[model samples]
Structure formats: C-alpha cells, structure tokens
Target chain A: MTKRVFKAAFVSSLPVLMGYSAMGMAAGILLAGTVKLKFLPFWAFLSSGINISGALQFIMVNWTEALLPLTQVALLTFCLNVRYAMYGFSLIEKFRPLPWLKRGYLIWSLTDETYALEVDSAARTPAGENQLDFCLGVAFLDHLYWLIGVTAGAVIGAALPFDSRGIDFAMTALFLVVLTDQCQSKINRLSAAVGIISAICGRVFFSTSNMLIPAMVMMGAVFIIFRGKFERKPEQKEGEE
Target chain B: MSRETYFLCMTLTAGVVTIALRAFPFLMFSGNRPVPPVIRYIGKVLPPAAIAMLIVYCYCSAYQDKSFASGGFGLPELAASVLVVALQFWKRNPLLSIISGTILYMVIVQNFV
Candidate 1:
C-alpha cells in the first residue's frame, strides 16, 4: 500500500519536479554569479534546503551580497511570504491529528506547490490508501528536487566561462507573472494599484535600498483606511472558492 | 562580522521566521478560536500588493545607474517586461514566458546596447 501511494504521489509531482528544478537553477545561478561568496554551492544548498521558498531564494541573493540589516531582511521576508500564514488555516484540522514530528515536517514544507498537491491528493485519495504517507511522499520528493536543482545550478554557474549579465531579470519576470495572475480579481487589482503608487512614492522619497519598508507601510495604511473597499463581501468570497 | 558568519546568521533568521509564519495558523487557531476578519482580509489582499511593489522595485533597481539617454534609454527593460506579461497572459506557461523574455533581454543588452 505504501509503495502504491508513493508511486501515485511521484506521478502527481512530476510537474513540480520540472518547475522547481528549472526555477531553482535560475535562482542558484543568480546567487553564484552575483554574490561574492566562497564555496558557492554549499551556500546554495543551505539556503535552498532551509527556506524552500521560490521568491525568497531569489531575493536572498541580493540580501547576502548587500549585507542588508537583519531587521530589514526579516521584514522583507515576511512581506514576500505572508501568504504562507493563511495556508495553514485550511490545513489545521487535517494536520491536528498527526503526530508531532509528522505535523511539524508537513508545516515546515508547506510551500505553495506542496500545499496545493497535498490538498488535491487528500480530496482524491483512494480508499485503503494512507493520506499521511502520500503527503509525506510528495513533500520529500519535492524537497529533493529543489535541493538538486539549486546545487547543480551553483556548480554549473561557478564553472561557466560566459558572462551571465542580465540574468537577475528572472526575478523581475517572476514577480510580474505572479502579479498578472493575481490581478484577475477586482480586489487584488485595487490592492496592486495601491502597491505600485506606494512603491513609486517610496522610490522618490527614499533610496532604492530603503524603499521597501516605506512602501509596505503605505500599503498597510491604505488597506486599513479603506478596508471596506478592499475586503471581499461574503458572497464574493464564496464565489472565489 | 565575517562574511561567512553574517551569511549564516541571515540564513538562520530567515529560516526561523519562515517556519514561524507557516506554523502560526495551526498554533493560534487550533482550539476553535475564529480567525479575525482583519487578519483574513490582510492575508487575502497583501500578496497582490506586495508582488506589485516588488515589480516596481525591480524596475527601479535595473535602471538605477543608467539614465534615460543611456542603456538603450530603458527600452530593453520596458520591452522585455511587456513581452513577459503578454506571453504569460497568453500562454499561461511561466517557463516559456520567462525563458523567452530573458533571452530577448539578454540578446538586446549584450549585442545592441
């Protein structure tokens, strides 16, 4: 039974394998070519293994090279990944009955891709198949793919003879893709406009290195001051799901 | 601090914060306490706003050192970004969109500029 579940999980995770490996290689290459760190592959492996976050993995290359203050790093990390906090709400009941170790691993590895697969697998789980085992199988395989992609990219990047100029644009492209997807909703569009205006204002008033916090502050203020406009109505929220 | 130690500290800080945030909902609302509406609203709206803010920041950083008269007058950045958004919107394939857009930007900057 366990073997069968693992096989099913592997089949479902093939798409993630491609996505993570390609994306991870981009991030790892950026880290190696941009940052001046020695033992580049080791750092790549460490950051990828620990964070397992797509955006943060890319952004951290900049943070390390610039040696940004810890407070700023923490805040930026939170702003970029705050969505993970809400992912747990849907998973709370399902994970409550799990053992401490198993639950902890699941929570730790609750990336956007992994979370989506877990939820889908649960809904479609065949009877007599253990859901927890399937979840674990998916989580472990995804984690391994990310690790391999990043480390391999670092190795290749360090050995490359050609210039890697303009590769950092991958991060910008990623952000644009995500924003385009999000803007499909009315509420998201309003919030994104506020964010763009706030960031432009921040760039005008503050240095590029110091703009993010101010932008975040302005964004939060706008969201609060106009909560009624931004918050979804109950019926609209239901429709979204 | 040495660079190695600084990197380590930063990694640890980021890792701990990430794990804590992921664990938040489970730790707080496990026992039947309803999530606050304000918190829920922020969670829903923050991702789009934050992502948009980052896109602006990327543009600012890419052109920070170059003026409008130089580096193809920011044309590469603008053109490539448009291509990315358009391809992503049309194909809905992230890898295709990013790879094609980045390659175009690279060729323009490396050869034309």
Candidate 2:
C-alpha cells in the first residue's frame, strides 16, 4: 500500500519536478550572479529549502542585495504570498486529522504546485490507500527537486562565465504565465485589471521600490468597494447548493 | 550585523511569515468554526490580483532604466511577454511557455539589440 501510494505520488509530482527544477535553477542562477556572497550554493540551498517559493526566490535576490528593511521584507512577502494563505482553507479538513509534525511539514511545503497536486490527489485516492502518505510523498519529492535544482544552478552559475543578460526575464515570464492562467475566469479578469491599474498608479506615484504596498492597498480598497460585484451572486451560490 | 547574519534574518523573516500565513486557516478554522464570508471573498479574488500586480512589478523592474525609445524600443520585453501569454493560453504548458519566452528574450537582447 505504501509503495503504491508512493508510486502514484511520484507520477503526480513529475510535472512539478520539471517545473520546480527549471524555475528554481533560474532563480538560483540569478542569485549567484546578483549576490556577492561567498557560499552561493549554501545560500541557494538555505533559501530554497526554507522558503520554497518560486516568485520569492527570484524577488529575494534583490532584497538580499539591497538589504531591504525587514518591515518591507515582511510586507512584501505577505503581498506576494497571501495567495498561499487561501490555499490552506480548502485543505484544512484533509490536514486536520494528521499528526502535528506531519501536518506542519505539509503546511510548510504547501507551495502552489504541491497544493494543486494534493487537492488533485484528494479526489482520486485509491481504495484503502492513505491519502496523507501520498501527500507526504509528493511534498517530499517536490521539495527535494526544488532544493537540488537551486543548489545545482548555484554551483553551475558560480563556475561558469556565461553572460546571463536578459535571463532574469524568466521571472517576468513566470508572472505573465500565472496571470494569463488566472485571467481565464471572468471574475479574475476584473481583479487582474484592478491589480494592473493599481500597480501602474503606484509606480507612477511612488518609486519602483515603494510600489507594491500601495498597489496592494489599492487592490484591497477596490475589492471592498466593489464587493457586491466581486462576490459570487446568490444565484450561483444557490446553483452550487 | 554582518551580511551573513542579515541574510539569515531576512530568510527567517520570510520563512516565518509564509508559514504563519499557510497555517492561519488551519489554526483558525480547525474546530469547525465557519470562516467569515469576507475572508472567503478576499481569498477568492486576491490571488488573481496579486499575480497581476506581480507581473506589473516585474515589468517595471525589467524596464527600470531603459526608455521606450531605447533598448529596442521595449520590443524584446513586450514581444517576449506577449509570446509567453499566448503560448501559455494555447498550449497550457507553463514550462514550455516560460522557457521559450526566456530564450527569446535572451537572444534578442544578447544579439539583436
């Protein structure tokens, strides 16, 4: 049973393995190139292992180099990662019955791809097989892939003398892909527009370094003001019911 | 503080904040207490907006120094971003789209401009 769950989890995580490794390598290379640290691979391992965030991995490079204020780091991290907070809502019940350590690890490693795989696995658990075991397997493998990818990239980046110009666009492309995917929903379209507009306004009014906080504040205010429009209609709720 | 210690603190801050956010729902609603509708609404709408904002931020950083008149008139960034969005929409494969777009951007900036 354990072997079956592990196999299934491995299969499910293959795509994540590819995605995390590629993206993590990009982030790690960026870090190695940007930061003048002595132990590039060590930093890569520590950051990727602890945060396990694709976007943060990229953005943190700048933060580390600039030594941005801790308060800003905390807030920016919140803005960039608030979506993760929502992910746990759908997973609360599934993880509730887990032992504290297991559940804590699951939460710690609850990245976007891992969360999607876990939710997908929940739907298709094989008979008599433990879902938590499958989830743990997926989480462990994905985390491992991420760590290996980032560390390898750091080592390679430090050794090679290749010009990395324009490579950082990978981060931009990643955000674009995520935004493109999210824009498929009608409700999401409006929110995305609000975000784009707010970000532009923030950039215009404040410097680049100080834009995101204002953008987030504007986004929250707009959502609250237009809550009636943004919220699901009663008809849709009834249909779901 | 030294650079290493500062880096360590920053990582810890980010890690702690992220774990706290992820654990918020589990801690608050573990005992069958219903989540407030406001919280639910924010959850649903926040991701798309946050992602969009991040994309904008990315662009701002990428073009921070280059003007519209210079650096290939912002063509590389715009073209690569458009390619990424279109490929993602059509193929639904993130790895393919991101790699393709990044390569295109690198080639353009490295050789063409």
Candidate 3:
C-alpha cells in the first residue's frame, strides 16, 4: 500500500521536479554569483530547505547584498507568501484529522505545486487509501528535489568561471510564466490589471525601493472597494475542491 | 551583528514569517466553523493580482538600472517575454517556456548588447 502511494505521489511530482530543479538552479546560481560567501552551497541548502519559496529564494540574494533592514525583510516575506494562507483554506477539511506532527509538516511543505498535487491526489484517492501518507510522500519528494537542485546549482556556480551575465532574467521569465497562466481566466485578467496599475502608481509615486508595500496596500484597497466587481458570483465554483 | 549572524537571522525570520502565513488560516478557522465570506473572497481573487504585481516588480528592476539606455533599450527583456508567452501559449509547457526564454535573453544580452 505504501509503495502504491509512493508510486502515485512520485509520478504526480515529476513535473514539479523538473520545474523546481531548473528554477532552483537558476536561483542558486544567482546566489553564488552575487554572494561571495564561502560554503555557499551550505547556505543554499539551508535557505531552500526552510523557505521552499521561489520568489524569496531569488529575492534574498538582493537583501543579503544590501543587508536590508530586518523589518523590510519581514514585511516582504509576508507579502510574498501570504497566498499560502489562502491555499490552506481549501485543505483545512482534508487535513483536519491529521496528527499535529504530520499536519505541521503538511502545512510547512504546502508549496504551490505540492498543494496542487495533494489536492489532485485527494480528489482521485480511491476508497480505503491512506491519503495522509500519500500527501506526505509527495511533499517530502518535492522538498528533496528542490534541495538537490539548489545545492547542485550552487556547487556548479561556485566552480564555473564563465560569465553569467543576464542570467537574472530567469527570475523575470518565471514571473511572466506565472502571469501568463493567470491571465488565461477572464476574471484574473481584470485583477491583473488592478495589480499592474497599482504597481505602476507605486513606482511613479514612491522610490523604487519603497514601492512594494504601497502597491500592495493600493491593490488591497482596490480589491476591497471593488469586491463585488472582482469577486465571482456565489454560483461560480472556482474554489479548489 | 556579525555577517553570519545577520544571515542566520534573515533566514530564520523569513522561515518563521512564511510558516505563520501558511498556518494562519488553519489556526483561525479549524473545526466546523465556516470561513468568513470576505476571507474566501480574497483567497479567490488575490492570486492573479499578486502574481501580476510580482511580474511588474521583476521588470521594474531592469527599468531601475542606471544603464537602461545602454541595456539594449530593454529589447532583450521584451523579446524574451514575447517568446515565453508565445511558446507557453502554444505548448503549455512551463519548463520549455522558461528555459527557452531565459536562454534567449542570456544569448541576446551576451552577444548583441
């Protein structure tokens, strides 16, 4: 039974393995180039192991270089990751009966891909399967893949002597990929417009370093003010099952 | 604080904050209680907007460069983004899109500019 669960979870996570490892390598290489610290791969391992976030892994190199204020770090981390909170809402019932340790690990590893797979597996789980074990297996495998990717990138980056100019565009390309997917839905298109406008306004009004918080605030305000407009009608079943 | 200490602090801070955010909903509305309508509303709508915001943030960095004019007038970014969108739309394969786009940007910037 455990073998079957692992097989299902592993098959489901292959795509994430490809994505995370590739993206993680880029982020890891970025860190190696930007930060001159010795034992860089060790840091990469630790940070990637704990955070499990793509954007933050990329953004942290900048913060580390500047030694940005801890307050700013806290706030940016919050803003970047707040979406995970929303992801938990859909899984609350599925995860309700899990023991504290397993439940805690599940929440900790609830990345976008892992969450999607967990939810997918849950929906497809046949009667009498150990759903909890399947999810845990998926989370653990995804986490390991990410760790290996980042660590490998760091090791390779440290050893390479070639100029890696413009590799940072990988991060930009990632965001664009996510945005393109989001824009496929009509409602998301409007929300995206709100975000883009809010960000542009923030950029124009505030200094570059200070734009994010204001943009987030503005986006939130706009979303709330037009909730009726942006929020789908009750009959819509877009929420994850 | 020492550099190592500072780095550790930053890592722990980010980790703690992320865990808190991920766990907030579960802690708040466990058991049979219904989630607030407003919270559910935000959950449904916020992802697209936030992701859009991040995309803007990514490009804004390049725009912030002091050498924007010298940086091929942002042509590399624009071209690569177009490639990514077109390829992703056609293939719907994220790895193919991202890797191709990033490599194209790298090649363009490395050779042309």
Candidate 4:
C-alpha cells in the first residue's frame, strides 16, 4: 500500500518537481550572481533560517550583505509565513490521526505548496491512500529541486558569468504557475486578492518589504472574518466502504 | 564560516525538518476518526489566498527601490508580467508561463532590463 501510494504521489508531483527544479536553478543563479557565497557558508545561511524560519533563509545572504534592516526583514518574513498558522490549524486533523513520530515528520515538510496539494487533495478526495503521501511527495521533490538549485548556484556563483537579471524572476515564475493550478476556485482568488491589497497597502505605508507580516495579519483577519461569505458547499464524498 | 560547521547546521536544520515534514501525513492518519470542524474549515481557504498573496507580493515588491524610466517598471518586468498573465490565461500552466516569462526576460534584457 505504501509503495503504491508513493507511486501515485510521485506521478502527481512530477510537474511541480520540474517547476521547482527550474525555479531552484533560477534561485541558485541569482543567489550566486547577486551575492558572493561559499558552499558551506551558503548551507549555513540556509540552515540558520531553516532553524526558526524557512522563508527567511532564502533572504539571508541578501539580508546580511545588503545592509537591509533586520527588523523589517523579520517582519516581512513573518507576514509571508503567517499563512503557516492557518495551515497549522487545518493540519490538526491530519496530524491528530498520526502517531507522535509521524506527526513530527509531517510538521517539518509543511510548506505552502505541500500544504496546498495535501489539503486540496484530501478535501477533494478524502480517505484511502493517505494525503500525507502527496504532501511529502510534493514537498520532498520540491526540496530536492531547491537543494539541487541552491547547491549549484553556490557552485556556479563561484565559476559562471550568468545573467543576474534573468535569474531574479524565478520566484515570480513559480507563483504564476501556482495561481494557474487554481483557476477553478473563486474563494482562492478572493483570498489572494485580499493578500495583494494588504501587501500593497502595507508597502505604501511601510515602504519596506519587512511589513509583509502586518499585511499578512490584516489579510488573514479579513479571510477569517469574511470566510462565511466565500464558503463553499461541503464537497468531499470519498469514504471507505 | 568553516565548511564543515556550515554543512552541519544546514543538515540539522533544513535536512531534519525536511525529513520530518515529508514523512508526517503518511505516518499519521493511517486509520481515521471524525475530523474536527476547524481543521476542515482552515483546509478549505488557505491555498488560493496563500498563492494569490505570494504572487502579488512578489510582483509589487519587485519595484520597491528601483526605477523604470516612465513610472518605474523596467521593460523586462512589464513584459514578463504580460507574458505571465497571457500564458497563465491561455496555457493554464504555471510552470510554462513563468519559465517562458523568464526566458522572455532573459531574451529582452539585451535591449531592455
């Protein structure tokens, strides 16, 4: 059963894995191009952020060398990740079903994309073949993609003469892809719209990327408060016989 | 930092976290019980909101301290944005849209930025 489910997840995540690998490459190129980093130092930077914050790791090299404000950086990161709390809330059911060891593992791989695939899949098709397989599959492949890219970026940064401008758009491209996958849903569009408005408003007022949290908070509140307006009819019909 | 020390930190931090999160769901919920209401609720709205916000923020912030000649969108970003929208609309594949957009940006940078 485990092996068969793993195959399903692997097949499902192939597209995401491809995207992640390419984007990771772009990220690597940018990290290396825009900044100087040695291999160990690079991983250390990734680790430092991973310990407390995964999003922040991506920015560590820039934040450290760019003379960006620490407070602002932290705020933006927190706001960007504020969705994690929401994701966490949703995960209680999935985790509550698991034992301690497994629950601990699931908590580790719960990034935005992983969470989306799992929640969407589970909600769309509940029961039989754990949703965790999909989450791990997506998260695992994406991580590999990132690891490969970041490691390469560190290596290439040392040797190559790649164009820095082309690489910076990686994240932009990744987000664009994610949005495409959700064209069927209206609630998602509404949620995204709220977050965008909050981000813009926060930017205008704060004029710094660091204010992402405040914007996230504002947005998250709006989502929860108005969730009823956008609520969908319960649709999950899958159950074991 | 020393290479060995740096690698150790990342292995412990990212590596361990990766292993845990990846393994989580499969291990738990092998059998089932009634899922609480809140969990069901949160699971519903997160993805769209999260993805939408991420994309918007990435685009909006890309122009923060930078200049764009007229109103401040360097040609490449503007072009890429258009391509992103059109590709996403027409192709409906996020990966294709962004990757193509990146390629476009790379191509146009010769004349633009």
Candidate 5:
C-alpha cells in the first residue's frame, strides 16, 4: 500500500519535478555567483529545506549581501510569503485528522505547487489508499526534488567557468510564466492590472528598497475598495436569492 | 555582526516568519470554523495581483542595476520577456518557455550587449 501511494504521488509530482529543479538551479546559481560566501551549498540546503519558497529563494542573496536589518528581513519575508496563509484554508479539513508531525510537515512544505498537488491528490489516490498518506508522499517527494535541485545548482554554480551574468533572468522568466498563466482568467487580469499600476506608482513614489510594501498596501486597498466588482458569485445561491 | 552571524540571523528570521505565515490559517481556524468571507475573497484574488507585483518588481530591480544600458536601453529584457510570454501562449509548456527564454536572454546579453 505504501509503495502504491509513493508511486502515485511520484507520478503526480512529475511536472513539478521539472519546474522546481530548473527554477531552483537558477536561484542556487544566482546565489553562488552573487553572494561571496564559503560553504554556499550548505546555506542553500538549510534555507531551501526550511523555507521552500521560490521567490524568497531567489531574493535571499540581496538580503544577505546587504546584511539587511532583521526587521526588514522579517517584513520582506512576510510580504513575499503572505500568500501562503491562504493555502492552508482549503486544506484545513483534509489535514485536520493528521498527527502534529505529519500535519506540520505538510504545512511547512506547502509551496504553490505542493499545495496544488496535495489538494488534487485525493482524486489520484487509489480506491483504498489513504488520503493523508498520499498527500504526505507527494509533499516529501516535492521537498526532496527542491532540495536536490538547489544543492546541485549551488555545487555547479561554484565551479562554473563561464560568466554567469544575466543568469538571473531565470527569475524574471519564472514570474512572467506565472503571470501569463494567471492572466488567462478575466478576473485575474483585472487584479493583475491593478497590481501593475500600483507597483508602478510605488516605484515612482518610493525607492526600490522601499517600494514593495507600499505596493502591497496599495494592492490591498484597491482589492478591498473594488471587492464588490470582482468577487466570484458564490455558486448555488444566485438562483435562490 | 560578523558575516556568518548576520546570515544566520537572517535565515532564522526568514524561516520563522515564513513558517508562521504558512501556518496562520491552520492555527487560527482549526476548530472546523468556516473561513471568513473577507479572508476567502482575498485568498482567491490576491495571487494574480501579488504575482503581477513581483514581475514589476523584477523589472524594477533589473532597471536599477542598469542592465539596460548595455542592451540599447532594456531591449534584451523587453525582447526576452516578449518571447517568454509568446512561447508560453503558443506552446503552453513552462519548462520549455522558461529555459528557452532565459537562454535567449543570456545569449542576447552576453554576445549582443
């Protein structure tokens, strides 16, 4: 049964394997190149294993190289990961019966891809297989893939002979891919437009170092003020109402 | 602070904060309660906007570094991004799009400018 669960989980996570490893390598390489540090791969292992955040992984070099204030580091982490707070809402019931350790691991590894996979794993589970076990299997495999990718990239990054200039464009391409995928929906397009405008305004108003939080705040305000316009109609209630 | 200590502190802080955020809903709403409508609404809508903010942020960072100066004023970034979006639209394969776009960007910057 465990073997079946692992096989199913591995199959489901194959797509993520491709994405995480590629993107992780880019971030790791960027870190190795830009941050002048010994034992870089060790740090890569530690941070990636603990955090499991793609965007944060890419930007961490900036924080380290600048020796950013602890307060700023915490704030930026929150800003970068605040979206994570919502991922657990949908999974609360699914994970409710889990033991503390397993649940904690699932939450810790709840990256965007992992969350999507875990949520969808129920349908993929064999008829008699346990949901929690399947989810746990998926989570663990995804985590390992991410760790391997980042650590391997760090190792390769340290020894590469060629100039790695502009390799950071991988980060940009990642964001663009996500944005393009998200913009396929009409509602997301509206929200993305607001985000773009707000970010530009923040850029115009604040220095690059200070623009992110302001832009986030502006987005929140806009989202709230325009909530009535964009809220998806709760299904099954429109006709009765 | 020494460099090692500073990095250690940052790693700890970032790790803790990220864990806290990821665990927020589970800790707060573990009692079988329905998620608040406001929270639900934000959850559904925030991703695209946040991702959009991130893309702009990336562009701003690149601009700050003056990467455009070598590429005839940001031509490489502009062109590479167009290719990425176009390939994503056409092929719908993220791995191919990202790798090809990034490689294209590296070539443009390394050789052209």
Candidate 6:
C-alpha cells in the first residue's frame, strides 16, 4: 500500500510539477519586472497562490496596483474562489472523512490544471485510497513546482534589466498549453466552447468584478441542461491500468 | 466610490457568495434526493462551458470587441490558434497544440510582429 501510494502520487503529480513551474516562472517575471514590484510583495503573492492558484493571483497583482483595502481583498479572494465551492460539491463525498487540516490544502490547491489532473486520475481509479493518494500527489507536486517557479521568476526578474515587454505572455502560454493538452475528447472541445461563450457573454453583460459569477452560473446551467448528451458513458472500469 | 472601497465591496461580496456557494450545494444535496435532475444535468457540462468562457474572456474584452483587432491580422496569433486547432484536431494532443500555438503567437508577437 505504501509503495502503491508513492507510485500513484509520483505519476499523478508529474504533469503538475512541469506545468506550474513554467507558469509560476512567467508570473514572477511579470510581477517583478514589468510591474517593478519588490520581492517581499512577490513572495507574499506566491505563497498565497498555494491556496487559490493561477487566475486569482494574476488579478490580485493588478488589484494590488490599485491598492484596494484589505477587506476588499479578502472579499474578492473569497468570491473568486466560488468555482471551488462548486467543485467542492463534486468532492464532498470523496473527502468528507478527512480532517480540515488535511483537507485544507487538498481543497485549496485546486488550480485549474490541478483539478483537471486529479479529476482525470480519480476517474481512472476506484473511489478509495488510490484516488485520494493520486489527488494528494498531484497537489503536492503542483505546489512544489509553483513555489520553485515563483522563486525562479523572482530571481530572474531581479536580474534582468530590460523592459521585458512580453513576460506576461507566460501565463497566457501556460494556459494555452495546459488547455491544449487536455482537449482530447469531444467533451473537452464542447466544454472549451461553452466556457468561452459564457465568459464572453458574461463580460459583455456584466462588470469585470461580477463577470465570473454569471459565467459560472451560466456554465452550470448549460451543463445541467445537457449532462445526458455531454459525453459518452465511461466504457472501461477503473483499475484497468 | 473610491477604488479601495469598490474593491472592498467586491471582496466582501466575493467571500460571502463563495462560502454560500460552497456550503449550500452540499447541504442541499446532503440527503441525496437524487441530485435534482436539473442540477445533475447542469453538472454534466458546466465544466466545459465554464472553461470555454474563461478562454474567450482571455482573448476578448468586456465590450465584445476582438482584442487583437487593434494589431490587425497577426500571423503569429493566426499561426498559434490554427496550430492549436489543427494539432488538437488531428494529432489530438491537446497539450502540444496549445503549446505550439501559444508559443508561436507569443514569440511572433514579442519580436517580429
């Protein structure tokens, strides 16, 4: 069991380790260089990212420029995490047994990439230790990469003196990369379409601050409306691997 | 409102709404009354739609205008998007296509275009 857990953890975490590191690197570069932010603030942002991951941090960096009040920050941070609230529903049955301390990172480390990985791996394994182990491994691995990338980006940002006009592209690139890698099925394609459409509509109709909620709600509505036809039934049993 | 106050309001609203979203769904479904057909249905495709909306959000603005329009027909962006689509469709490697296309666009835009 110990060996199995280790194996599951390592294999599941491999992608996260690779992806987050690159993304974190890009983020660090932007915050430190283009924005000319200090290391302490950058560090603060990176560590906090362990909880919410990618998008929020990017927004936070911009918000910091605006220098909003702490209450606003906490509120927005909490609200930005609403999707996780949604994701949490799908996971309650799976993690209800764990203590919040153990579940804290487990729930908190759910970046977009991490969630995709854990969800896919969990679907491949039975709803037990193997699944849990895989999920934990992915989180641990992804988090490790993010920390390293943050440090690296900070260091590099400190070193480089040029304008570094294109540093922000790193996040965009990472997103495109992770998204492309995951889009193997018709379901993924449709999901991408739905996400894009809903976000565009949401943004057009709503303020930037409020766009995410409506986007999530609309996506949720669409999914509920078409769950039966969204994807084919799972053809294989778990543990086939 | 001042920027700080506006952000503060946004922050508070986000926190309350998020906690409610997270906590409410589970409590409502705790008894397992068959997942209300409507909810279960929504669950099926919400992830995709949500992700798609985010991507579109990344490219376009709140006004629904093409962000790239200011720059005109960008070869790199074109290359990257096309590469992502074609590679994803043919080789079906979502990662490869995304990387190639995004990188192509980033590189193309950064230096040449």
Best model number under lDDT: 1
Candidate 1's displacement at residue A142, Å, is 1.0
Fraction of native contacts, model 3 = 0.71
* lDDT tens digits, residue span A1-241, model 4: 3776667766766766675555555555655666544564365435433433334344444444444544544444444444454455566765666667656655665666667677776643335877766566555665565566556655666576755665556566666666666655676777677767877777777755555666777766775666566567544432211
Query: What is the per-residue lDDT of model 5 for residues B45-101, given as tens digits with 9 covering 90 to 100?
Result: 887887788788778777775656654588888999999999999898988888888
| Cα lDDT over the full model 1 | 0.86
lDDT of candidate 1 over A1-241, digit per residue (tens):
3788888889888999999999999898888888877788998899899989999888887777668889988988888889999999988887877899999999999899999988887764557898878888898999999998999989889898668888888888888888888888898899899999999999999988899899999998888777766765642332221
Following a full C-alpha superposition, what root-mean-square deviation does model 3 have from the true structure? 3.8
Worst 10 residues of 3 chain B by lDDT: B57-66
lDDT of 3 by residue, A136-159 (tens): 889999999998899889989889
Q: Which of 4 and 6 is the better model by DockQ?
A: 4
DockQ of each: 0.80, 0.76, 0.68, 0.33, 0.68, 0.31
Q: After superposition, how far is residue A13 of candidate 5 from its true place, in Å?
A: 2.6
Which sections of candidate 4 miss by over 4 Å?
A1-20, A40-146, A233-241, B1-39, B70-75
Second chain of candidate 5: TM-score? 0.83
TM-score per candidate: 0.95, 0.92, 0.90, 0.65, 0.90, 0.62
Per-residue lDDT over B39-94 for candidate 4, one digit per residue giving the tens place of the 0 to 100 score:
45554565556556666556655565565453235667777877887888887876
lDDT of 5 by residue, A169-219 (tens): 887888788889989999999989988898899999997767778888888
Candidate 5 or 3, higher lDDT: 5
Winner of 3 and 6 under TM-score: 3
The models' CA-based lDDT, in order, is 0.86, 0.86, 0.83, 0.57, 0.84, 0.57
**What TM-score between 0 and 1 does chain B of candidate 2 receive?**
0.88
In model 1, the runs with Cα more than 4 Å from the true position are A234-241, B66-68
lDDT of 2 by residue, A1-241 (tens): 3888898889899988888888888888888777778777998899899998988888887677667788888988887888888889889888878889999999999998999989987665667899999899999999999999999988888889898888888888888888888888899999999999999999999987788888888898888777877877732331110
Instruction: Write the residue-wise lDDT of candidate 1 on B1-113 in tens digits.
Output: 87777888898889988999999999999978999877888898899989999889888877767775677888998898999999999998998888888888888888888
- Model 3 pairs in collision: none
